[model samples]
Structures are given as C-alpha cells and as structure tokens.
Target: MDNLLSSYSPDFPVASDGTQTFDRDALQERIARVRTALTTRRNPHGAVAILADNSPDWLAVDLATAQLGLTLVPLPLFFTPAQWVHVLAQSGATALFCAQPQQGAALGFSAMTDYGGGLLLCEAPARGGPLPLPGARKITFTSGTTSVPKGVCLTSEQQWEVAHALHRGVSGLGIKRHLCLLPFAVLLENIAGAYTALLSGATMICPPLAETGLQGASGFDPQVCLAAIERYQAQSIILLPQMLQALVAATKPGDARLACLRFVAVGGARTPPRLIELARMHGLPVFEGYGLSECSSVVALNLPGAERIGSVGRVLPHRSVRIAGDGEIEVRGNLGHYLGEAPAPDAWLATGDLGHIDADGFLYIEGRKKDILITGFGRNVSPEWPETALLGTGAVAQAVVVGDGMPFLSALIVPATAAIDAAQIAAAVGLANRDLPDYAQIRRWILVAPFTPANGHATANGRPRRQLIQQHYAQQIASLYDTTEHIA
Candidate 1:
C-alpha cells in the first residue's frame, strides 16, 4: 500500500503468475554484490557495458549500476557485431555483461561476465556499500543508420528529471498498467515506458518484443500483440506510427478485444490522421506524441484528459516551448545539462523538428527541418506530409521524397504487399499528387525493395532513416530524373 518512491522496498514484487509475485529483494542484493565486486577490483571509475535482452536481470544490472555509482552503457540488442565493437570502444566500457558469454566473447571485450538465463546471483560486499554519486553517467550510442553513430551522454540527474517531469505531467491519472512495445535499449522506451511507469506505481508489462505490433523486419507480430493485450489486460501502451497503422490494418472494425485499454501513445515519427481515425474506430485510444532523444524522450504528449486528434498534445507542465523565427522548435525549462559539460543558461535545445502550435495549445508537427525539400523553382515542401498522403492510399507501404537541390520532387516507394503491382503504386502516387502542389508533387518515382532494420534504412523505433535511405538508394534516386522527359 506504500507509494512508489516512498518505500524503495528492494523486496517488492515485480512479476506474478496469478499465484505468487517475484520479489525484487534478490535484485537489490545483486546490486550490493556488484558494488562489492567493483570496489574490490578498484574499478569504480570504469564503465560497465550491458548487452542483453529485456528481462529481470537487465533491470537488476541497471539498478545495480545505479547503486554502485558506476557508469552504465546499454548496448543495443539489434546492433551488428561490428557496431557492437564500435560502441564498446567508443563508450570506453571497461567491463562487459551479457546473458551469453559466447556472444560477448565474439564482441572482443577485455573482460566478460556471463549472467546465465537472465538471472544473476552475487553476494553483497561487507564494506563497499552504495555510493552517493547521485546516479549513472549513462551513454547511449546513436543508431547510425545514416551517418556515424555518436555517444549521447546523459547524467543520472538529467534522466531522473525527465522521469519526474513525465510523472508530474500524468500524475492526475489513476493507477495504470503500461505495456512496453519498444526494446528497453531505446531511450524513449527506457525513460518513458519504464521510468515513468515506475514513478506512477504502474505495472510495466513487457510482452515479447516480436509480438508487439512493431512493423519493421525486427517488429512484433500484430496478432501476438493483440493476444498479449488480452492476456495481460494492458491499460496503456506505446507504439510508433507504423505499428499503429499495422494494428489498424490487422484488426476488424469495432473489435472489442482492446476494450480494457485506455491510452495508446504513438510517436517516433508522424502519425497520419487517417491512421488515428482508424485506430479510434477500432476501439483503441491512440494519442500522438512528439519528442526526440535530446529532450530525454518526451516534451509533449496528448493526455487522455486533454486529447486532440492531429496534434502531439500540449507541452508537459515542467517544460517551456516556443517556435523560433526560422521555424525550429525551441525548448527551455526543466531541462538537464549534457553529460560531459554543463549547458549554457540560454541553452534552448533546437529540436531539428519544425512545427507550429495552435491557439488551443495543441502541437502540430510538420516535419524534420533537415528533411524539408526545396525545389529549383524555390518552393518549400515537407516530404513527410506527402509521404503520409501516399501511405494513406493503402497500396504504398513506405514513401521517401527527394527534391533538395533538384528541379522537382521525386519519390521512392515500397509496396504494401508483394502482389501489389506497379499500377497500384502509381495509383497511390496519383492520389498523393492530388493533395500536393505541382512543385511539391512527385514527378518521378521508382518501386524500391522493402526497408529493413538490418540495412539501417529504418530506426529501431520504426522511423525511416531518411539520410540512410537516401544513401542506400542514391543511384536509383538519381536515375529517377535521368530521363529527359522527367527533367524540368
């Protein structure tokens, strides 16, 4: 009956099987043990690299690192072996932890510890207990889908501030349950899904990642996601725009399977209004949110109490936001300093995103500032707007618009189904053109193969890696305008 932050009961139960709950006392003990081990080795300043799937042990390690006052770097689960090496070296992680030693050994780290089957057991140290160093100096490697990935350093205080802001933002809501769909390695999910849920005394239900309605090659099966929702009776969940679209496609009209659900937050990219409408019609309360990694995951979210259809919702209570003269979103209050050095007083984090706020205070995200295309005739265009239009046609699975430094805009599209012919794609393009101006319209397009996470064409959160996609299909994109008839 104790409040979430008040008790700090290390013995509190985390999971249950209808009969009994799994206590977290052992996890706290493991943290004590790890602290002892690190102190005995005189390596408190060293960084610990954790490469493991989501499980009880992962939480244990995270909590343990926090208790020990040691730096923790969570390695992405989907990274290639080469990427793993790059992150390990770039992060300067001295110790590596994994569920599988063989895989850890392959990564070629100096020291490796195998905590088998996602369970770690260690004895508490007598002398070296917890440290008062505030919290972790966490470093998360960027998903270098387009360019080289950089290490984003965040302090524990900063992370905790973000969690607190989210807690304050949603505090009025009653006790809720959160179903985590994205991988824990993703900062958005880690902070918002896990930390915010913890702050709210909410139960965090993590179904298998593959069954969570994610739409990429590495995404979850929509059917499995629905079944998990029914089994757990999840009240709230998170999804990317693509996953929301997929769920809308998979479910029948007026399906009551998700009747228990209250809120389904969709982000990581723009959510089409049509998809939101479909999800609402299918009995899912989908709310679109807007955020980026630099802002500690969430700056604005549409709450159930103050819902809006197309906007990402009002700015959270602790945050201050404004649009710059150049159309960039500038955010200020309740912000944290970057890891390495203190931020300046006027440190207005320029969210490379461009959007406008309406008189009613709802945020309508236009598109990425860098992704905005301007034609040779001097017309501004947001590729995402047109891409969303193309996707709503149902035949196009994905669309990327290219027009920067070009005479006119062109598009590269992927079909929704393997059997979908070129004519169908063209028809979708035609529909998209109807809503666009001549300068912003796609004059030429090519049917490209499916975008996949393995190739780095899409982010782990399912947003298209526009720069990477442009690089991957550079030749094809150029070929689109190679024909004399298509050239302006």
Candidate 2:
C-alpha cells in the first residue's frame, strides 16, 4: 500500500469535491492521524466497523485500519435496520466510526474522537462470533440476495492487486478527473474507482450520492448527473447498466454536456450492446465490464483501445480465466477468501456465472448459472440473454424472463417511462423478439410498476430477488400462463 501511494508524486491531488481537497501527502498524514487516535483509545488488531457516507474521513478510516493491521468492515448505507444489525453481530465488530452525526444513537454507541470529516467513533458490545475467514483484513457484506447478506473476507493483497492492475490497465487513457458515482463502501468503487484514480495521479471527486444526483439505488436524475460532469469536468465515471440506460434516455443526440467524459465503465449487471451504442450515439464514451464481490470487484474490463462491444473485454493481466465443464467461468490467480469455510487451497473459484472467453480472449457472459431457464421445448436458455435483448429495445426499465419447464418464455416488464403504454412496450418487445430464435423470444409479458428494495422486488444493488418477485406478483405471473398455477 505504501508503494501504491508513493508511485505518484505527493503533491498530486488525491481527491476533492469542490470545497475540500486531499493531496497525496495530506491523505497519508490523515491516515496516520486516524490510526494514532484509534490506537490511543482501542486495542490493536481488532475489527473496526465504519458506517458512513462517502467523505474524506471514510478514506482516512480505511487507510488507518489497513496501516494499523486492523480489520476493516464497511457497512453499506443502503442496509435496512435489521440488515445492519445482522452484519454488526455477525462480523463481531467491536468499534464503529460513523460520519453521520446521529448514527451513534441509531446504532447505540457513544461518541469518540472526531476524524477529519467530522466522523466520530462509536463503541459497541463485543459478542464473540466466529471469524468466517480467520485472518481476513476486510469483510464486505453482499447486498442481501436472500434475507441475510453474506460476508466475504478479503486480504489486502487481493485488493491491492486489483487496484494496481486497474491503474495499469487505464494508464494509457490519461484519466485525470474521476467522479465516484457509487458508494465508497462498494468494493467496485473502492478499488477500481478510488484506488485506481489515486494510483494513476488522478483527482478523485468524493461527494455525497445526492450531490451527484443519485437517490438510494433505484432513483436517478440524469440532469443532475450531467451537471456534475459539466461542473467537475470528470474524465471518467463508473455506472451500473440501469444508470447508463437512464442517462441515454434523458440525453439528446449531440449533447455536449458529457463531452468531458473519456471513459464510462458500466458493469454491476449485464449491459446490453444497444445501451452501449445508444450511449455512444449521445457522445458518452461508455464501455461494458463484468465482475462480482468474490473476485474482488473487477475481473475484466474494456479499455480505451482494446474494447469489445458485446463482450466484457479482455481479462486483467493479474488473473486467468478458464471455462469449466459445466460451462461456468472458472477464475484463478485472483480468487479471494469467502467469510465462511475456506475453499480447497489453490482451488479455482467457479463463478456461478455462465460465460466463455472468445478466441481473442474477450469474455461474453450469458447469465447466472442458477438462473438458466430450461423451456419445455427441450431447449436451454439464459434469461439474461433475452433480457439484454429486450432492454436494448428501449421499451422496458426492468425485465425478468421466466419459462422454466413452461412452453415458451414470458416476462414481467416495467415500462421505461410512465408515458409509454403497453402497446409501445409490446412493439419494443416485438423488436427484441425478432433477433432471437423461436423458443427464446418473449411469448407473454405483463407491464408492471418498477421493482425496488422497498417493495422486496429487488436487491440493494438492483438485482431482482427471483423468489420474492415471483411471489409478490404470483397472481399476475400465473395469469400470464392462463392457469391458476403458482410458480412452484
């Protein structure tokens, strides 16, 4: 980590958001200051939990713990009250540093010394809990695909490797100003977004998500995003597929507001090629990539010169990818430790995702291994395969394709805009169906309201909770089949 910070000049700007600034030197000193304060009041080598919005103090706490050789557990801002309790008790976190002033009472902890960004340390009762990964330096919880979120333990080595590789990969692009669009707690942004920018001597803008025009995970205001780009003149930003889709929908052709963007990496979920093309048509330099938390966020990315539109781009130099016999993507060389029961030593991690590397080494992800829908016609399909095509048709904001053991595929479609009617959406679905084979096209669909975490229809990161969504819309889904049968 020292080597990473030292690579760029100390005077280089590490981060800022108009008002506050942290040069390389200042950031290193702040980390040292935070470490000193924590050590005076607490013991060394204990787990320290931090719950806060993105700020310089968040970075300071992260670096302080890493420097002190203490475990850092970051709790996401989106977690429910019950979900947050589960993590705190599950991870065995004894101390907490919260940036929000009232977080202390909410989490039941008294105040400690203030960090640079007005962050206060909070005390918590230490209940003995098993360490899923015994020697893990960091624990990041999943966004609760089920009712409980899984904690993934990772060492500093794995994180630094991803960050260094990211810096090396995008060095040639001359990325100077990077606006962090996602939560700093998100591993994707922590490594690829913040670490990569600092390592490459770029200025990282760490502002509140609301300031950047984002509300929770599902809400977005494109004009706010555009204004941020114009004001900060950020050369690069990271986004999910849904965010990119929103931007393209709101933007007009030849819009020069986004002209400052050099590289826009979209991942979190599968990105449709039409979405990428639509972004390009509006002069947004969007590139598609794929990754998950277990692999330490970034696995493959489409760089500036060597980009594949449909594929998720070439694998990083630090990692190796091979397809398993079951058609799952097996990743080696960069696999991190899972919080519970470590895998066999040096065993290849089988990513539940189904994908294959192209002849040129670019990866094309099909969909989740568990999500493969086998139609009654004896044909197998990846729901994401048709879903991507459907999303590309610009008719739906969200889609879930289901046809397991059924005659043909059917979907629950959320109209892209409130103004768009079922007829317009039907036409769009028809356009998507043209590109697919007979068995893979959408045979039936029902327009519905958007899926959100508040409604128990999706995860915090925007992944559809298949079981909950299926159950919540059980009646409508059954009607699509013209049978009163449940999707058992």
Give the TM-score of each candidate: 0.86, 0.95
Please report, in order, the local distance difference test score of every candidate based on alpha carbons.
0.70, 0.82
Colliding residue pairs in candidate 1? 210-220
lDDT (Cα, 0-100) at 40 in candidate 1:
54
Model 2 lDDT per residue over 1-488, tens place: 65556755777778786578888778888887788777876544468888888877788788778777778889888777787888887877777888655775577556456755457877654447754455577898886568787888877788888888888888888999999888888888888898788778788898888888788756878789889988999999999888888899989878888989888999888989998999999989998888877778899999888898999999988788899888999888757666666744356888898999888999989999998999998899999998999899876889999878989889988888888887898788889999999999998888877887767688766778887878788898778788644221
Model 1, 48-122: lDDT tens digits are: 778766555565566666656677778777777777777766666666667665665576543433333243222
Off by over 4 Å in 1: 1-13, 16-21, 24-42, 110-136, 144-147, 171-175, 211-217, 334-342, 405-407, 484-488
Estimate the Cα RMSD of every predicted model relative to the unseen true structure: 4.7, 2.6
On lDDT, the candidate that comes out on top is: 2
